[model samples]
Target chain A: MPQTADTNRRVVLSERPNGLPDAKTLQLEHSEVPTPGADQVLLRTRYLSLDPYMRGRMNDAKSYAEPVKLGEVMTGQVVAEVMQSNCEGYAPGDHVLAGSGWQDYALSDGTDLRNLGQTPQNPSWYLGILGMPAYTAYAGLLEIGAPQPGETVVVAAASGPVGATVGQIAKIKGCRVVGIAGGPEKCAHVVENLGFDACLDHKSETFAADLKAACPQGVDIYFENVGGKVLYAVLPLLNAFARMPVCGVVSWYNLSGLPDGPDFGPAIMGTILRMKVKVQGFIIYDSFPPSLFKDFIRDMTGWLESGEVTYKEQVIDGLEHAPAALNDLLLGNSFGKMVVKVG
Target chain B: MPQTADTNRRVVLSERPNGLPDAKTLQLEHSEVPTPGADQVLLRTRYLSLDPYMRGRMNDAKSYAEPVKLGEVMTGQVVAEVMQSNCEGYAPGDHVLAGSGWQDYALSDGTDLRNLGQTPQNPSWYLGILGMPAYTAYAGLLEIGAPQPGETVVVAAASGPVGATVGQIAKIKGCRVVGIAGGPEKCAHVVENLGFDACLDHKSETFAADLKAACPQGVDIYFENVGGKVLYAVLPLLNAFARMPVCGVVSWYNLSGLPDGPDFGPAIMGTILRMKVKVQGFIIYDSFPPSLFKDFIRDMTGWLESGEVTYKEQVIDGLEHAPAALNDLLLGNSFGKMVVKVG
Candidate 1:
């Protein structure tokens, strides 16, 4: 059913999960639509973004971001529309990028809203290619990874938003791009569609050897979004002075306990020392200043318009599907950037 | 023994050790003193530097540099006198820095020689405070760690050459420096002599808590020379945007096998991601260009002359003591930069 003017539907965190979030993690609730106060705007979430980072927010542990509290609205960003505006420079029916979260309606003081104007082509793109994920890939690949021409760049989670963008940008910078994904379908898409030089199935029995064979010259830049076995395989293959830009660890987010193995910490740190590798972790929030954001938006827009870069997104309909979709995302069951069409 | 013109005493690698090198690892060999050919100079070893990194060179495995082959002269640098010279611009009785290894005499073809000039004051300082260890500390701390004023800087192996230099430089940069040493005596010296704000004994039962108490503000720059338990302690105490410059991993160098424990690799990488930390491994060779080396020499000379930085050295008499000295250095039994007074 479409969002109604008098009622608001919200998904609230009910309990913290021990491992992967399940049915008891969230609950649906109905409430009266929040009204705008003085200099305030009422935002109705049109599209809610479901990202791997949100899985981290579900836990009570300290991370780069704050954890979502029980019974609170699940923290997220949305492509929202101004349903009512008592604020300056805002009018009804205007689209915006706001932290409206997993709710039908929210009250905003205009502090966190970026104006998208009266109409926009592909408004949800503000949440994916033209927004945080793309900016993450751009800044991380360029600033930290510092890809050089003819160098090898390895990106994990090949078909995901950040990985796809990183691989394509590496390719643009004249580097040989190698992508790692869970299945053959995603691997095929990564090479044929995303234009990676090679895409290896991370689940393959010979994944490590296959990766070594694919890159004659060892990896120079590793865009690390997936940790676990993928990182284990990539560690030995990294060349001297390799740069690893750590964006996320989606693979380990759901892990409740340590995996059984010999403590590989020494080996990892040893490789980093022996190879003189640089490993830097980053989050996109507050990292991109106005100048960088402008550059990203300009370049990313042109790339999309000129067909130099392509984006794939998996849109799940309805607000209730967000919880399950996030689970799917963590399991690598969903391909591309997954989002919820809330309204 | 003082001036052996007819015979040269050399220490060669007898075998690669599984763990720590013992008496059988290196063998003392006697040979005739080599005559310098055309464009070559004969160097009589005056002082030979023993370092922890030499332990890695003793292993047959690949590392940042080549391993020392069995029966080959063990690789090292020395402050030597040019007893004979056939090369232009080089003459007899001039002191110079050369990779002469653990030997009484070596022939150089005018390559890898840094002339110290005749009558140079404190020629041995060129191997410690004014040389590779100091340079490694300077570049790794400033170039990679990038300490800011009012930040917390932590140095492992604080009594060692590199760590001492790193802690002092961080202090000079207006950072609050915390030093980690093996014993209380070294800890006291680190604070009272080296000018670190505080020094903690890593062997203490409450070492981790003591470290936490010392640095009220979380660590911003961690000069990682000693890994193992020290790194495990520092991992949790790192603040956002912390920098860890991996110059050496002395603690793990002698481990012939993995330590029995749950693999801490995930936790290490996870902490790195959550804190947005930067960990970079660096080696001194070929890293310091002429410009950087010049700056390092000028600044270091000034620091020493002005008493802004103090250096400590433990000089073992005789070249035959080098292998035992290195073992002592690795076990943290020797304090300061250990060297041998070879003639």
Candidate 2:
């Protein structure tokens, strides 16, 4: 049986980034689409998530997974359609969760793709709130931080997918949620929409003071996604027994080398000792045991269904815009989940 | 009953020390001892245990307890016989654990004294294994470190009381123990008499490299009793998810201020995050919930009785020698518990 030529366009990393990745770091290429073999499925990328985690994938550093190799398509989560499949439970046109990266089309071995039946509830939600970022917030905040009612939970990058979810969950747990975002608009949205008790503008000169005032009772849990000055500010005001579950250090992602300042490692450990604080670093993959996936989906699906947890998405139309959108996302310019619409 | 006249012999701070205490920083003065009140007891110090923790008390910084007042009696763990007692449970001839300090005799209201029975299992053992130093090692190593069998436990200042006890307990739990001490003699004593798997002399020219070789399995539980260079050396070799129970910083305690040169606080926290290590600073006074004391004593007494553990004491005769002895103790010159017999 003869088959038509593969029709797929992918954005590949043309070069490793210098400081912040520019459009020059990526190249949009049209190539023959890969055919799904037996036990594999042909996926048409529907929504490609541009996340802060992709920054880690861009660099060849030690992380939960290997970094995306140079000249390869950038790696990310995607919502896609199964055009053809030899895998069980997935048929033609059936929507699924996939890691199709920066492409218009991809082929999955059916290893980690989950089916989404017809009549879906926010199909792109599977790329975000119903997926990895949301789960990162849930597991790290609840399981590790273990915040109590009235305890203050402070989350940096407060308006993004992970931080927004973390803040809302903390609020839902009856904790006073203080969110820190880069600007007043995002901070307001965090407080108004996400139900955060207070929100601080990290870009403001009085950011540290404002954070201190907002957390009158001192912070009990700091869900650390942006770990730079935000961490520096959080350091002094941490009450004894504070729990810090560190997922990402987005603030320092673009750095090619060490910053221009004295290293604060000893003082941080001293504060950790003086306060008996626990700072745990985990990727979502390591944060939760795999067995908790079903429970997470069940609980989170209910929360979304009940409207207790709401999500926001900043969609950039076209795969051609992904590189720029991701660059902006890395710089904290995006207000929520940055998804590139491919199909 | 009266104390042998307050010889007025006392070790008082003459000046604060920088790096290490010298004779210029401390002075011995003969002063008259005060009389006991109706609610107090007159204690004639029989055995004074010079502990590393006293180094921290010599500093003016806030800690688990108040710093020793300048010109006041130096704080220490003393095993004394009651010369006179108006209080119950403590009578003439009864041995007691008291903060009798570095003095010829002291008047007490029985504030920080716990009386030991006359039928003693080596009364000085109270200061080493059954008293504050022992409890510090036990609570920190057991509660904080939580070493499992076959895990490798590394302790610095290994021939000292706390480190020795930590090594023995790690061995009893069936873990391989690597002891780091000051000299070849102490290291030999640690391995042969204490039955550690291996002992490394930290003062050796190949100290860091030798430690790396000796700890081929890497350090699973690093009982951080000393800080400074030892900490710098251990940081890289820490296994993922290693536990560091920091009880004291004898290495930095004698310093008048923070250690000089490059600050590595962020690097340390980064190591902690990337390695998922748990470095907790603890004070035993906070750990003992009172219910565990009886169990601790029973087990320790049994261990001592069965000759499973050996304790060493370096007794300096007379109260007048305390100032010089304290200087030497802070400099890591003492081989074991440095006790001044203040009879």
Candidate with the greatest DockQ versus the true structure: 1
Q: Give the range where candidate 1 chain B is weakest over 10 consecutive residues by summed lDDT.
A: B284-293
Rate residue B261 of model 1 by lDDT: 69
On a 0 to 1 DockQ scale, where is model 2?
0.35
- As a TM-score, model 2 comes out at 0.88
List residue ranges in candidate 2 displaced over 4 A.
Answer: A1-6, A12-19, A22-28, A58-62, A255-261, A291-295, A302-308, B1-4, B7-32, B58-62, B69-73, B100-111, B201-209, B254-263
lDDT of 1 by residue, A204-292 (tens): 99999999998888889999998988898898888999999998989999888677768788888998999999999988875546688
* Candidate 2 lDDT, A209-237, residue by residue in tens: 99999999888998888777889889888
Q: True contacts preserved, each candidate? A: 0.71, 0.26
What does candidate 2 score in Cα RMSD to the true structure?
Answer: 3.9
Candidate 2, position A167, lDDT: 87
- Clashing pairs for model 1 are A263-B263
lDDT of 2 at A264: 52
lDDT per residue as tens, model 1, B1-343: 4437788999999999878899999988999999999999999999999888899999877688899999999999999999999997678999999998999999998778999998779888899999999999999998999889999999999999999999999999999999999998999999999999999999999999999999998999889988888998999899999999998888989988777768788788998899999999988875546688888999999999999999999999998788888999989898998889997
What is the Å distance of residue B329 in model 2 from its true position?
Answer: 3.9
